[model samples]
Target: FEYAHETPKRNKRKNYLTITTGAPTKRSYLCVQSILYFLLLLNSVIAIIMWATNWYQLIIYKVQVLSNNSLNVELWKNPTWQPLLSIYIFNYTNVDRILEYSEKPNVKEIGPYVFREKANKVNVTFYQNGTVSYQVRRNYTFLPEKTRGSLNDIIYTPNVVLLSAAQMIKEKPWFVRKTLGALISATKVSAFNNFTVNDFIMGPEDWFSKIGLNLKRALGEDVPSKFGLLTKRMGLSGNFTMNTGKYNTDLVGQFEYIDGRPGLGKWEDEECDK
Candidate 1:
């Protein structure tokens, strides 16, 4: 029994290997941070490309001038000079950038643009029926040549009204129909941006449409729509401009007036505004 107990000897030791999680966790965290940096870079690039390029703003003024044969508007008659304004939208560059963009020249413009007026609509009878003659004329051009202001090429065409025939005014007398009163006016026009959301990729119109896309698309040329009555109204008129949807303006002068001209008084009296 003693010999048998001694023969059955064996070593029993517990050997163990441990795997730590810290290294794997650190690797995974680094990978996530790398992805985040890449995503941020891409987002910044997209934002830069979508920056605004061509910019335009328009201001419209409506003036209803009350005039009879005695005091017709005389401002338009002096051809020696003309009242006008001009804005040049470049081919993505301007006078300063001309050096940078010398090779690519695209000067777009809102030309020697100004409130040009139609000829006076006069039914003057100097001798009270000496010659019962009435004359009316209306024409519109985006920019006229040699006007007062920097002149540019006539790039845009306005809605022009050409009177083709005698307007059958009234049955009783020509004088009765013509004496109602005359209105002087200006305008703002509307049209769908050339692109939809589908084409918003780079269309300036699409960017502008952002002002009121749904309303503008539905209205589709709100100002032009009302143009039907412009040519046949109380007096002559001219046209074009802007994306701001506008409505008919109330008469300011006859009822109340705003001396639109600065440093000027009543245009009727040419006296300083008091």
Candidate 2:
């Protein structure tokens, strides 16, 4: 009988074992894929929740200049017109906290306090290149939800307003000038609320903390360029005194102070100051 070499049963058995072990490996791979899918789903759910709750908080303060006398936009933009001021106002400040972090500044993001336009807030009038009068009708500071106010609440109109001074000066009609020259600015502001700049802070991370939070230490109430300092530099000190009121705690309160004119007649004439 021709002895044909029979294939070894042991080798054949070993190959079968190897093929069978692959089933567990396949199961493990499927488990890993399932875990990855679950993680992705969890991430998606968290993103949706964040979008609905905390992403839409924003406050906008609209600036409007209205006068009894018609203002020529073209004329106001004249080269001779002085650049009065770029009113940099904010609702609050946390410079003391920001200063703590220089390199590895551990920072935390706070809130979305919103300002709503409302009536009976603050109104200032101007005329003859001077502030004729102003009124703090109602306290403007409020929590975001409290911003339900009329159109007149947020619009600012002034008569005899002095925008800035480089050296010069507008010619309005007599009636227009007179109307704008009135000492009292008319608005829907309320008299019941007379809060100052300091009354509205609920907490360090509240609404006021979120609006116009200035980090610049050199500006605002701490600086020499404030109303009092600038006047003092011009040798016009002792001319007037200002009585400070409380600030709005709801939104951040910016320039809000009452100055008592001690007979401004002592101010140097235009030619003399020049």
Candidate 3:
């Protein structure tokens, strides 16, 4: 009886040891599982952060590219009237191409007048006293029908003389008169490549509209609807005349707001305002 009782006690002690050991093993497994879950969560958070940053950068780059492209297209289309005038002035005085001049007459000054003609080109002479005379020609020949309009009618008159105007005077006041004389003297310089009727007709707004149309066609349904809406709101439609008047207003206003702004001709700003 004693031996049987001792054996039962030993068996009970063994069972207790087994239960304790198994409990520790189970706890270790649980701990490992919890660590793995934590690592997974951290990785997911890092991935989300990287993805968001990339998306933001992409969006910013896209906006910048779109804006720059739009501006470039506008410049290409409009080519600014001042630059064209500069080119014309350069051509008139520089080249020996002006017909009817016995010699390359020294053009002492230019402007305080707006002069334009339908001929391949036209020449305007500005004397010392501010009186202006212009001749129109087709292929270097005076075309009576084409040149019928008065200087006021034909030329898109300038608001200020290229030299005597306040803006030019202020920006280069000391050299204003001298620069005008030099420009006339140097009229025989190279012709301006970008000046064209297309540039003359198309304004900044027209350029944007044309670019938007082309973009729309290229992108088709891939373009975002919101972008299209924005373009429309910015007046990127085909009606250039409406925007032309506003842009002209802004241009004139720029000169007016500046301290040394030139005194533009009444008809010059008036025509553009209309």
Candidate 4:
């Protein structure tokens, strides 16, 4: 009876095939896990790249200058856009009537003589404390096309030097006034002078200025050599000390000192000086 029960042999090949089929499901699950991990790694790399790009943009925004080492220094040294000066002169229309008939002076306003001005920083000295000291030199060039009147046009203007001198010495001693009158008579200086617009604004040293300047010097008065509308301001500006915007961006071009003084002492109040 035992020999009959053991007669049926098990199918070993069928069992092996079933085991191999089950192994394929496990392999598929592992492949899916690997795919998920690769997707996660790709997403993380993209996020990191975006963050770095944002950081680089922030750096650029913080330093909005031409050079990384210097903070808006080049632009401060030389401005791209130059300012323009427009001058208007009063033309004496009825000088003869006013002088001969004692009539009120008739004046007519003329022009818009335009000039382009260029200011350059000179004698620049940079300090280690993020400050810069320099002087500004201003140059003006006449813009013929922009001017309303021709420079060669004759203009009748009052003798500014003579009038100013008369007013200054009016309160002085009689001897001083008599001396100035004699000087004016000797020079044959008139009450008004006829000059070209160009000469009046920027001169070849008019006769009145020369004689007036000499008289002023004889009186021991300090005065400028030339007298014109814009001639006095054509030179270098006073010494200026300013922040270079290195430490604080808001302090660029702010004044620290004018000439050698921290503030102008001409005012009565100390706060007004600043």
Candidate 5:
């Protein structure tokens, strides 16, 4: 009777032990499942955020194109023409700057004009006389260094605009002289109905000096001739003046206040010395 009673107690203890162990196992499984669900939720949230942002950008880009004029094929193939077209299209479309050129030589002919958030606005015009002009307007208060090169490259790509004024004079001396004379004559005829070599050439010394200066500046060394100096000086002076602002009258008084200060010369360095 005592042994049978002990057997029932032993059986009861075994059942309790099993139930305690199983309780902990079920709790661990629940915890693991909860953590897995949280991780999946987090991943889904991140993916949704990325998709929303990208989709918004795409929609904005599409909406910005107001006209189909931007899809012209001739403008895409010609680098010289594309810059001007980009300026007009962007201005009319009221879109942010995003045009980019392709790098691959083969595709370079095709172009990869993409919009970037931070590009300068270029004013482009096509004249009735078959000339395409590009004017770059810097958005920043301070001027950027690369702006000049960018403008020149856009206008002067291969077979685009003709050579620089100095290059044209050198390569076609008679033609340049005749053209300059004709332009002066036409202007005079329209105004006072008279023209002369004096009006067109400035002076023989001035012409030679201007040409020599331009050549020297363009080639970056003296070419050992009167004409070379003229070209270099002319080109250098023209480029310098075009890039810089005119001196302020208020600054002139301040400059005169200094002892032994030089007056502003025709060029930029001279003005700095004052």
Candidate 6:
């Protein structure tokens, strides 16, 4: 018998095409990680560059003081503001009553004489050791609008010259004091004098001041030729040396020396001299 082999029909291959979103594969994840790392590195590099650039600019503008530093130097050398100066005077109305009648002196407040002070840094000299020396010249201009009283207003007050002269000789020998007292008595100078505000503040070019100046000169005292409340300080002050902030910003404008002296020697006390 010829039996035919049974032929099993092959099942039709089912081709079901389904598409769905899912997490990235390992290769794609690694690529994304590399891109993120590249971006982070770029940001870090940019930040470092910006920090360095800002530091350099700050050093150049703020810290370093050189001839080429135009902005700082210009502002320092020539200031635009005019500062105000106020003066108050006390007038003794009852000097004679206090001296002769033994009564309390009547005191009166005179004024608030305002003035516009102009300052200039003259003779600015720079040294190689990062130091600068300069002299400040000051001038006062009366501002009548801001003043409570006139400069020509006359008022009576104690004689400052006479008192100062007496104080100077008080500690000296008794003979010296007596001789000076005789000289002062002969001049007919009283304990009080009438002076204008201008004369008192600027300086009184009167007979008393002239006589006092002459006597002090004769006595070999180191006193100013002209005596006034603010006369001697009206002109240029002494020379001052300061750091330039070239190497150290903290030391900028710090006084290295004043009038070539490291410390002031005008006071009697050692601590006060500095």
Q: Write the per-residue lDDT of candidate 2 for residues 138-161, one digit (tens) a residue.
A: 122334453233212222111101
lDDT of 6 by residue, 89-160 (tens): 998888878879989888999789998888888899888788999998888999999999899999888888
Which one is best on TM-score? 6
Quantify all predictions' global Cα lDDT against the true fold: 0.32, 0.31, 0.34, 0.81, 0.33, 0.83
Give the best candidate by lDDT.
6
lDDT of 2 at 242: 23
Model 6 residue pairs with clashes: none
TM-score (all chains, Cα) for each model: 0.20, 0.18, 0.17, 0.69, 0.17, 0.76
Which model, 4 or 6, shows the larger lDDT?
Answer: 6
lDDT for each residue of candidate 5 in 127-217, tens digit (9 for 90 to 100): 3332232323221121223222222122101210112333545645686567745644554311111112222112223343454355445
**Total clashing residue pairs per candidate?**
2, 26, 13, 0, 26, 0
Report how far off residue 180 is in candidate 6 (Å): 1.4
Mark the regions of model 2 whose C-alpha exceeds 4 Å error after superposition: 1-103, 117-132, 141-274
Model 5 alpha-carbon drift over 4 Å, by segment: 1-11, 16-58, 62-122, 125-134, 137-211, 214-274
C-alpha root-mean-square deviation, each candidate: 26.9, 25.3, 26.7, 13.7, 25.3, 10.9
Worst 10 residues of 6 by lDDT: 62-71
Off by over 4 Å in 6: 1-70, 217-223, 266-273
Question: How well does candidate 4 match the true structure, expressed as C-alpha RMSD?
Answer: 13.7
* Comparison by TM-score, 1 against 2, better one: 1
